[model samples]
Target: MHALVVDSDAAESSFLSAELQRHGFDAQECVTGAEALEIHDKFDLLLLDLRLPDIDGLEVCRAVRATSDIPLIAFAAGDHGLDRVLCLQAGADDCLAKPYGLRELIARIEAVLRRSGPARTAPRPATDPLARGSLCIDPLTREVRLNGRLVHLTRKEFDLLHRLAADPHTVHSRARLMTDLWGYPAGYVPDARASRTIDTHVSALRAKLGAPDWVLTVRGVGFRFGRA
Candidate 1:
């Protein structure tokens, strides 16, 4: 991994850069925000100091974020809560307070690098519309049409359709549906009232599609998409 260390303190940058190199990183050192801005794109990871003589560190973070999704670890004033929050809001992947341990810093860098994998940098693949006879559902655009007529469905209704349709052969349980579509926490046992919410939406979805079998209730379990 390539790492760029930017700090006003020459010794600090040199030490950090050298340590990163020792840990299998191709590291580069720079003293000012301008230097960092000019050549940051070439590097895969950035170790930025939030205090610089020429430019505000937050501005540098914002500038870099606008163009690239490079993994960034900003060294900010740790005691100040606002400073840390601002660093994150300005687009730093993670922030660390100074007087930190080298071991911890290295771990954080590796963690960030792992998270910002090649998949994240690549463009999203195009998703083809899910077509079933007279009905068409577009996952990318979240639009649904039945018999060539645009069917206006509420967000929840559409989500239910797509989820069940995506795996039409499989039965999706009520608890599982609640957790996946409604953002319910894991291991949550839905009560009768919560269970009714899903049933209500499914009924509305079936009505909108003009067919009850599109979403078939599997008796005691939950619902599934029926091709017919």
Candidate 2:
């Protein structure tokens, strides 16, 4: 698969790009987030550095996520806990603290892809439920079971949970979910109400699901299921 690496550091960018290429994947390097957005749709995945010359990587991640669902991996030069969280909140699939081994980077890439890959279109039973660790969601009954007990969820909560559970590790933006759940009707600008509604639904969903952190906040973008 083809991947793009967005980094301002020339040597680091070249090294990562070359390493990805050596692994039999087509890789390209871009020096700025602006450039990355200009061609975001062309790549399958993105390796983005939190620091950039023109824009913060979080902004880039948010912008790209406005329309695309491409996997994003954020890179940091040091242990910036808040920055890493911001990256994840910004719709990055995961973040890598700086000074990490190249092998670990590749492994993360593979693991993210594997975890986010599409599920098979199967004929689910009338009450068929799927489980991932302690989380369980029943598609037919619209019931959520966490730790083997029925949990309560509002309509929007159920919809949001269903959406996230549809694809583990897949990053989704608030705008996307709003459209999917509420349809936005027409000519609606995403405002505080939109954000609050989604957040409320997510909060209730998490409380009932018994895994508050299962739904992750990607800073300025939206939320995603699974860990960053």
Q: Cα lDDT of all candidates, in order?
A: 0.82, 0.76
Model 2, 119-211: lDDT tens digits are 233222345576767778887888887778888665456667777767767787877676566555333466864676577677766666667
lDDT of 1 by residue, 1-228 (tens): 888999999999889988988999999988899999999988889999999999999999988875555788999866688898888878787899987899999899877766554223322333789898899999788899998899987556777788788778989898877666655655668886467667767887888889898989899988889883
Scored against the true structure, residue 160 in model 1 reaches a CA lDDT of: 78
Error of 2 at 54 (Å): 0.5
Q: So what's the TM-score on candidate 1?
A: 0.54
Candidate No. with top lDDT: 1
- Model 1 lDDT vs. the true structure? 0.82
**Residue ranges of candidate 1 with Cα displaced over 4 Å:** 118-228
Each prediction's TM-score against the native?
0.54, 0.55
